[model samples]
Structures are given as C-alpha cells and as structure tokens.
Target: MKKIALAFLCFLATDSMAQVSQDSTISAKEEIEIIEKDTLFIDMAKYKLTIPNNWKIKAGCTEEQCTANSPQDTLGGFDTYIESINITVNKLSSSSYTAEKYANFSIGYLPKVVKGFKVLEKKRLNSYSYRVTYTGSKNNIEQTWRQYYHVRSSKVYIITFSAQARKYDHYQPIMEPYLASFKFK
Candidate 1:
C-alpha cells in the first residue's frame, strides 16, 4: 500500500513538471500581458496614488471609501482577491488625537469582523504616525493585511493593503511601494 501511494505521488509530480515545462514555451504571451499592465492615474481627488490601470477601477465606490483590487478579485465586494487595498478617511472630533490612539479605538472591532485575528506587527513611527500588519480568516479565506495610520490634524487616513495569504509575498512587492506615493491634495 505504501509503495502504491509513493508511486502515485511520483506520477503526480512528474505530471506537474511536464505541465510546467510545456507552459514555459508559451510564457512569452503571459509575460507580455503582464508587461502591458499600466498604472497612470495618480489623483484620487483628496489623495494621489499610482496603482495599476486597474486604477481605472471598476467598483461601487463613493467619495469617502474605496476598494481597489487586482483582476483576480471578484467585484461587487472583495470577498475573494489575490490582492486588494482599502482606503478610508475619517474626521475626528478632537484635534489632538494621534494615530496610535485612533487605531486603538477603531481597530478593536477587527477581531469581531475577522474570524481569527492575529497582529503580526504594530509600530508607532512617531507620536502621530503608526502602522500595523495583521492576518486573519474571513469568509473562510486566510488573508494578510498591512495598514498605515496617518494622522493629519484632526483627520486620520487609513491605507490598508490586503492579499490572500498564499499570494501575499508575490503581490506585496509589486503593490506595497505605492503606499508612499499618497500625496494629499
């Protein structure tokens, strides 16, 4: 029985390798499709960002909140996505609030919204700047989230990048740098 299982595994591996070898021959078209991806629109009114031409987004978005995603993501909502980013802007009543305080207050509800929340990293860059990387399961999908908390006077801008846990490493490098491109207008 063990030999049968081993033989089956070896067959599967050989088949997979053959597929990879065959696919490599036509990878140029796939590579061209990827090279064709563009991200030019940088002005989102309140803030500017340079993401993919998917930047010419197709979503149900309002002025205050928006969801951006890669082509692999489903529309109507982001219950499924290989990569996604959510931007939210809010006004605080008190002008003295800091990013750390704001995150503590609002993010308490995350665990309730996410099935298994675990904070990977939380850092306060300064009194007014903070960032957090967390992961959890939601809608039965394991996802990783990286959030930046930017405080400007009484307003706090939250920029969150989320991706499927399995795909996070591959897409994060491509999408994460745009976080620094945000320029308030």
Candidate 2:
C-alpha cells in the first residue's frame, strides 16, 4: 500500500509539471511580432535608442547649444498628446566629480529655483549612475521629473522625463522603455 501511494503521488506531480510547461509555450507568430521594434542610432554620439513608431522627434535646443561651456547634445520627441521626452548628453570638463556629488549639486539649487521643489528619490545605479526624481511646479502647473545621470569618462548623460503630475503615471509605461534604451558609446 505504501509503494502504491508513493507511485501515484509521483505521477500526479509529473502530470502537473507537464501541464505547466505546455501552458507556457509561445507561438511563432507571437514571438516574431512582439520582438519587432524600431530603433534610432545617433552616430555622432555613438549610442542607439529604441522608440515607438508613433513618437515624433521635435526640433529644439540641444544640450550643447543650450550650455556655453558644456559639450552636450540633446534628442527630444513627443508622444501622441504632444507630451515631451528628452535625453541630453553633457560632457563635463572635470573627471574629479563623483556621481553622488554631482547629484547633490544638481538638486541643491532646485528648491531656490523651482516652486514646491521636493526630492522624491535619490539612489545609485551601478558604479556610474545616480538616478533621481523630483517634483515641482512649472509655469503654475505641478510637474514630476525623473532623471538618470550616467557618468562616464568625465561626461554626464542626463535623461529626463517630465509630465504634468496627474499625467505622469499615464506616461510611465512609455517613459520607462525610453529611459532604459539610453546607451553610451
């Protein structure tokens, strides 16, 4: 009786495992369609980004053009509702600056310059990044901003995502992929 019970339990467990594996199988069409993506490569900067087909790239002042001393370049675009997303690469002149110091210096002046300035999160990402999020009012509208500072070779690549406070969550799904796509060459 003990041998029979043990054999039956083993059979049931094997059947359940087989069922789980069968349920997890992916169809060829699903695999191919879901894996297809559109990507953009910036040859001058030696980085590539993946963007959804619906997003449009807008012409605006890039980082290099905006700052006199910093050698920076910016790529920005908008979604279907015209919400803006931007990535700016700023090549700092000093290699002595650490990610923590840079992040602190960047946010230290925010409260003075921005209304309702609040730092939401500040943490390190690997050895070369300091990710930060803050909220403030811009032009009388509450806005949330997320920034990722990638420090490499005396350069800081700042990727910024901003949206009205209420719409911030709505745009997160899109913004997350855009943020993750940033690469330094």
Query: What are the clash counts of all predictions, listed in order?
Result: 1, 1
Model 2, CA-based lDDT: 0.57
Number of clashes in model 1? 1
TM-score per model over all chains? 0.68, 0.65
The lDDT, on a scale of 0 to 1, for candidate 1 is 0.64
- Candidate 1 error regions (>4 Å): 1-37, 73-82
Query: Please, what are the lDDT tens digits per residue for candidate 1 over residues 1-185?
Result: 53453344334333333221112223435534533443333345566655554333334444357665555443345445556677788998899988998888756979999888988889897777788888899889899888888888588888888888876665555565566556677
* CA displacement after TM-score superposition, residue 153 of candidate 2 (Å): 1.5
Model 2 sits at a Cα RMSD from the real structure of 19.0
Worst window of 10 by summed lDDT in candidate 1: 17-26
Residue range 77-176, candidate 2, lDDT tens digits: 3322234556677777689777767788889987887799999999898788888889988778788888888787887777677777766765555456
**Cα lDDT for residue 48, model 2?**
43
Candidate 1: clashing pairs of residues = 52-55
